[model samples]
Target: MLIVEDLLLLLLDDETGTPAKAGTLPYALGGAVLVELAMLGRIDVEGAGSVLSGPKVVAVGDGPLPDPLLQEAYDEVTRKPRTVQTLLLAIGGDLWKTVTDRLVERGELRRESKRVLGLFRTTQLPSAGTGHEARLRAAIRGALVDGTEPDTRTAAIIALLSGSGALPELRPQLAWSGEVYRRAKELEKGHWGASAVGTAVARTTAAIAAAGAAASAAVITTVTT
Candidate 1:
């Protein structure tokens, strides 16, 4: 599964078929694609270690990616270098639908359609009994709860989950603790070992967190007003 797919699975509520933190889903999904492209050597950030100034994302590879989604992201980067925040929206604007369609095609999720008052249509994606998400959760749970160091892909998912502020939602399954929270926070800092990948991932995670915070504040302000 692609990193974005894995991240989406973790964020989505299995029964509700909605994101645990819907406000950050778009940004997190976008960040997932950026992380995947960086890992694949298809993209990089302008600054390798600078976190103070916003990092601008750049496309480095000219070859086509195996997946259409990755190729689309790479092409967007090739158009022009943009700050991590801007690029996230650019890539993630309609990503939820695209990624959901991909998962449905793979049979990892099944789509059910319904009508409200026989006038409006809605769709929900429930698990297809693939058991992939179960294994994924086990691996992540081991990393967060058991202090097991995760591989690069797993680390990326953790970073996205942390940035989205969705880790606490794992709750009983993960048995949230101080150590688990600290481990997740460390990964969110994006020390991914490779210089280019690390910087890009770090910037993307930072952007996601910032965006999520702003969204929360806006919701609060609206409710208060």
Candidate 2:
């Protein structure tokens, strides 16, 4: 929803103390926008929350460094200049594999073969870099705005409709159904704060709908006359 997006943008701007560019805006604002839309019944809040809080692990090589070798290497490197071959032989095959795997994943180290010797022989190091946060933000924004995919566009529309209070009321007949009640309870718990703000939004939506219905009835009556 535009309102939710605007609010998120405002929050990010406040936090950063400046208007964020498109590149930076997505990372800072995407989570808030997704959360707000979920609160408004436009998106799956649970799924979004899970993605934001998923487990992450940082690997150093193919596996953990052997404790004895690691300690010795640390001391030796700090005290004397050792050759790469010397360090590899001292660290051993298993630890080196782990280290190589980790390096490849992070784009820091490359691998030519699955073999430990191959890992040691290949020696191209990637440059240190940062900017993934900006890319993530851009991707989220693109998914919302670009109508290329039907599912994404539909999600965007649902978010817009729900945030704008345009969704049809949960029918009384269906309200107490198991799924309905469960979802409602979940939403109530998750969106307690938003619900307080939503009272004003609901009232405004109701007033506008009522006014439109009345105007339509008047027009119909005049046409009949």
Candidate 3:
């Protein structure tokens, strides 16, 4: 499974069959793609004096990416010099549909559609089996609640969850703790693996923040316009 897939599974509400939040989901999804590409050595990040100040992401090793969604992201980045924020905005637009299609194809998620008030259609994804989601919950509980040492992927998931802008939506289910949130933030900024890999995560996370800001701005403009 892809890192983004794990992220989707975690972002899902088991009983509700809905995402924890709507706004940050796409950027987080895009961030997951960026991190996965970095993990595969298919992308590189360039930074100036500081980490968050003007980080540019470039694709590495010209080749066809296995996943279509990732390939699309890779293709867009290679076409131009994009900062983490710009790339998040660029790549995140269609991530939900792409990721959900993959999940449906793999039989990991069951998709259902319903009309809301007989006006608009809405989709929901319910878990297909217990094992897939159960393991993810176990990892989260172990890391956040039990204080066990988490593997790199698990650590990244925790960090992504914290950064995902859905904390309030997720807090009750996981028994939220301030200490856990702090640890995840530390890990998000810390090195998860090689120097390059860690830098990639930090840069992507900063981008996620920027994406959130952009979303907020868009909402405000829409409301006041």
Candidate 4:
């Protein structure tokens, strides 16, 4: 499964089977795609310090990314020079639906379309595969609540969620909002705990991704408020 797919699974509400924060989902997914590309060496990020400033992302390959959503993002990056936040906003708006459709095709999510009061149409995705989401939530909880070492994928999700202000939505169930917030700070500081993730991943990249997510969240907050 794609990293964004896993991220989206956690962003989803178990009880309602919809995203907890609709505005933040796209930005989170956009960050996920960039992280995935970085992990694969398909893209390169350059900056002067641990935190990205005047950072530039360039594609490493000549062809399209295997996933169309990712391909579109790649195209956008190549089309111009943009900071991580700019790229996230430029490509983020559509990632939620793109990833959702990809999930529907994978049979992990079942699509539901209906008319609201028989007037306007709406679409929803109910969990078709429960086991995956269960594992995802458990891993996140383990990282935040139980102090278990999280893998790179899990760490990325937690960082993105926390940065985007979406992690608190789970406080009603997990009751670990304080821990979650604390762990997010650690992740932002380039601590991935005692895991392979720490050795394999760079702190600067995590900071950049988190910054992008936080910037996107700020934009959303501004628009709504």
Model 1 segments beyond 4 Å from truth? 48-53, 115-121, 171-173, 192-225
Among the numbered candidates, top TM-score falls to 1
Candidate 1 vs 4: which has more lDDT: 1
TM-score of 4: 0.82
Candidate 4's clash total is: 0
RMSD of 1: 3.6
TM-score of every prediction relative to native: 0.83, 0.19, 0.80, 0.82
The candidate, 1 or 2, that scores higher on lDDT is: 1
Pairs that collide in candidate 1 are none
> Model 1: per-residue lDDT, tens digit, 1-225?
899998887777776467776765677788788888887877766654233224677788677898999998889888988777677778887899988888889988889998989999988887776889888888888778887777777877887788667888852246888988888887777654443345655555554444443444454467679
lDDT of each: 0.74, 0.29, 0.69, 0.70
Order by TM-score, highest first: 1, 4, 3, 2
TM-score of 2: 0.19
Stretches off by above 4 angstroms in model 4 are 48-54, 61-66, 115-121, 197-200
Q: 1 or 4, which is superior by TM-score?
A: 1
Q: Each prediction's Cα RMSD?
A: 3.6, 25.2, 3.7, 3.1
Instruction: Summarize candidate 2's per-residue lDDT along 73-99 as a digit string, tens digits.
Output: 344333433322222223232333343
| Stretch of 10 with least lDDT, candidate 2 | 43-52
Instruction: For residue 110, give model 4's deviation from the true position in Å.
Output: 1.8
Q: Give the lDDT of residue 28 in candidate 4.
A: 71
**Best lDDT among the predictions, by candidate number:** 1
